[model samples]
Target chain A: MKIAVVGKGGSGKTTTSAVLARTFARHGHDTLALDCDSNPNLGISLGIGEEATEALVSVRDAVDAGEEQHATSMDDLVSRFGVDAPDGVRLAVVTAIQNPEPDCP
Target chain B: MRVAFVGKGGVGKSSLSGSFARVLAEAGERVLAIDSDPMPGMAFSLGLEQSDAGLPDDAVEEYEEDGRQRYRLREGLTGTDAVEQYAQRAPGGVHFMQLGKARGPQWNNRRQHFGFQRLLDDLPGDGWSIVGDLPGGTRQPFLTWGRYARTFLVVIEPTPASLLTGRRLARLAETARAPRVVAIANKVREPGDAERVSSRTGLDVIGSVPFDPALADADRLGKAVLDTDPDGPTATAVRSLVQTLQKSEEQS
Candidate 1:
């Protein structure tokens, strides 16, 4: 089933969500944990080493850089970017925007 | 059963949320957690380093491409396929994705659709619990998603603003047809604080937590309070919250 944890800043939304994700992963079910917050620190809670992930490139950036067309087809996105399932659990990222400041170590 | 934990700012919702999840995991329950807030500092409280999962600048595309809403990001990521490649699998067996940040336009449309919600169709089976950490405000995203949740937990404080919002949330939940609504009092120091808030707001108090400096210190140092103080008052309160909710669900 799906569960969502939401609260104000300093109210423990991220901590609760991250811990729940870790706890679920520990329980051994194929689970997907998502950190869709603007502060962007869910990767750190999961013990990821760096802030860099190939999953972050955006369609807007591709267009701004002239990497794609003004109206790229959805089929083009799947063919060029999507990949087969990976080892362990599956992790995905979705957001409306990125941070102006770098949130890396 | 699924559980959604929601509250405003400074209510210790994150600590309680993560701690409750830890309690369930220790008891052999499969739990997945989703963080939907903009600040995204819950990582430190969950015993993980502080880092971002995705970059917002590239995640969503905003153009009225056609009659349908089309979005694409990450040159090598999934498109229109209803899934993205930026999600990362955590060590504890949970697969995680980044909702990153919302642009001003998307934030304005917070009442609309959260692209992440699409993952609901891809969740696990029964006996699994999922928790999401949301932002501080009682805006459309929380209210809208609150409608979809089977159980809604509102975090409250003794202050008028907090209690007022808590009650408003309860009414909204009732209006939206949430499966269940419960309130939690965080950092309760004054006697009858929860009761006072409840009596004035006319909402049931299902949980309470005491203030602790250890939690604040952990936040400053970038560490999980569980790792620092598992037996602390806040932790114990959170564990009890899990048991209480689990029992409530069982009885239901």
Candidate 2:
């Protein structure tokens, strides 16, 4: 089953989400989760070990990037680009825009 | 163990959450972190490079599942396929994932498609742990996250405004009849901060993370606080918090 964790910013929404997801998986559920907020951090929360979450290219961004050579459907979109999360959890996220300020708000 | 974190803005929830994950990993537990916040910086906190961290170029596939609007990876791909192919591997063995972000001129059109919803529906069968970093505020929770998880964890600061947000979040979770609703007193500057938050919100403060300048500095420097200072006060508190959470899990 899928679960969504919601909260205000800086409230530990991502951290709780990460703990819960791990708890579920450790309990033997092949969990799948996605970051739905505008300020995405679930990748880092999950411990992907990267300095930043891989901002998945959205269909709209693909079209804007001029990579949509042909009309694509959801089925093909993920098969071609869906990211493989650790421990068998699949992840799909929207694209991240480059922000100028490096500081947290 | 599926839980979501919620609270007001600037309460240090993300940093605490990241530290919690690191602590768990140090304890040899596998973890999956989901960043739902739109601002996007958990990776930096997790010690991931800004350039290397981000979602894939093609993260959405909009379509109809059973004659209703739905979203997921290309139609035929299983959730496992998505995990194996797309999930980015972060430090400390934690698997990282994110929802699609709307950027540029097509923002309006992109917002209309709920690809993230589709993904939540198609999550693979469980085994490893999952953590979701939700957006800041109650508005986003109502959009589609209200009933998604069994547990609701509210993180708040000592301030009245943060406590107010926590109270609202508790009410929201209660209205939804979630199995678990708890709060964490984060960035506590005084002795009674946790008690004050608990007394105000009527939700037990499961953990209290102290104010740590070192951690704040790490954040400002764009580095994971744990990576910057694993044995610091913040990390130490997170470790204890993790233990408390684990014990609670056992009791329940």
TM-scores for chain B, listed for all candidates: 0.78, 0.87
DockQ per candidate:
0.08, 0.09
Expressed as tens digits, the lDDT of each residue in B1-252 for candidate 1 is: 466677656666666665665566666776555566545455555666654554345444544466856444434433323233443334344333334345565544321133444344334446456665555534433344433356777888775546655755665555555678778888788879989768856778888887678878877787768788878887888888888888887898
Compose the digit string of candidate 2's lDDT tens values, residues B160-197.
Answer: 54665676577656564567888888888899888999
lDDT tens string, model 2, A54-100?
34554446667765565477656655555566666555555432221
Q: What is the interface RMSD of each candidate, in Å?
A: 14.0, 13.9
TM-score of chain A of each: 0.55, 0.62
Give residue A24's error in model 1 in angstroms.
52
Candidate 2 deviant stretches above 4 angstroms: A1-105, B51-60, B65-67, B108-113, B140-143, B146-148
Q: TM-score (chain A) of candidate 2?
A: 0.62
Q: For each candidate, what is the lDDT?
A: 0.57, 0.64
- Over 4 Å off in model 1, which ranges? A1-105, B54-66, B70-97, B100-113, B125-127, B141-143, B146-148
